[model samples]
Target: MAVIHRAELRPTKLELLAAWLPGRRWYQGHADADVVRVAAYRFDDPAGAVGIETMLVSAGDGPVHQVPLTYRDAPLDGGDDWLIGTVEHSVLGQRWVYDACGDPVYVAALAGVILTGGGQAEEFLEVDGRLEPRETPTLVSGSGSEGADVPGISEILRVIEDDPTLVVTDSVQLAVVRRLDGGNRLPGAALTGTWNGQPNPMPLAYVSTR
Candidate 1:
């Protein structure tokens, strides 16, 4: 389970994404467009050291984008290229945020989820020293079944950003859907999700053998 804090964030997640999204080749919105959160989900880090969250956001009236992010207390070694920016957390202090495509932890977690038909992490909000179960705004599930073998992904060999972002690993290639405009028909073990407006499940990512 992932714990949620009531603390405030300086230069909120949307604020940071608004500045970074335009730089990506697949981004279809204007540079100064207003980015708004649509829905979000989380994956738990087994070691509980990193916070993994995937957010679905829309830029003005444009297409929704899937942006997976990881939060850490310190900088990721040799990950300067993927660093989105840092934010000050009222409870966690300073946080180093990076695009999840470049984080090895996220890659492994995502692979495991896709291969094992796992779902997003359960969330609990910390309030006055008590943990309260919180309902996730979005729900996601994988296509593979439980007990399926999941390969270990030690590194991200390459990240190609297009309509769908591809992360190349030693064992498999992960295709992360960038724009949530529908009509994604990739074959392989995949992850799909549903949000408020989007009641039907849509493809979020898929894993293909290398």
Candidate 2:
């Protein structure tokens, strides 16, 4: 399960994305337009140290974009190239945010979900020393079946940023769709999701063996 904190964030997630999105090669919207959060979902880090989130956002009335991020307490060694920026979390103190494509933990979790037909993590908010179930604004699921063998993914060999961000892992390759459209029927296990105005499931990411 993913734990939620009702704390404040300095230069909020949307603010950071607004500044970062335009620089992305695959960004299809105007650079000066305002970016708004559409919806989001989370994946759990088995070690419970890192926070993984996949956010959907839009610039003005432009096409929706998919951005997967990972939050950590400390800098990811040798990941300066993928660093998005830092933010202060009221409950977690300073956080080092990075593109999930460059984070090993996120890669492993995403691969596991796709290969095992898993879904997004269940979320519970921390409220005055108690846990309260929180309804997620988005829902996501993988296409593979339960008990499917998931290869161990420890490192990212390469990352190609494009309309579909391609991440080459130690044992497999992941294609993370940057722009949200109708689902893409790729030749691999895929992760699909649905959010607010989007009732039909759309492809978010795909996993294929090398």
Model 2 TM-score relative to the real fold: 0.97
Q: State the local distance difference test value for candidate 2.
A: 0.92
- Residue pairs with colliding backbones in model 1 are none
Off by over 4 Å in 2: none
Model 1 Cα shift for residue 152 (angstroms): 1.0
Task: Give one clash count per candidate, in the order shown.
Answer: 0, 0
RMSD each, Å: 0.8, 1.0
200 Cα displacement, candidate 1 (Å): 0.7
Instruction: Give a tens-digit lDDT track for model 2, residues 1-210.
Output: 999999999989999999999999989889999998899999999999999999899998789999999999999998998899999999999999999999999999999999999999999999999999999769999999999998887678999988798999889999999988764567789999988898988999999988
| Candidate 1: tens digits of C-alpha lDDT, residues 1-210 | 999999999989999999999999988888999999999999999999999999999997789999999999999998999999999999999999999998988988998898899999999999999999999769899999999988877778998877688999888899899999886778898999998999999999999778
How far off is residue 57 in model 2, in Å? 0.2
> Which sections of candidate 1 miss by over 4 Å?
none
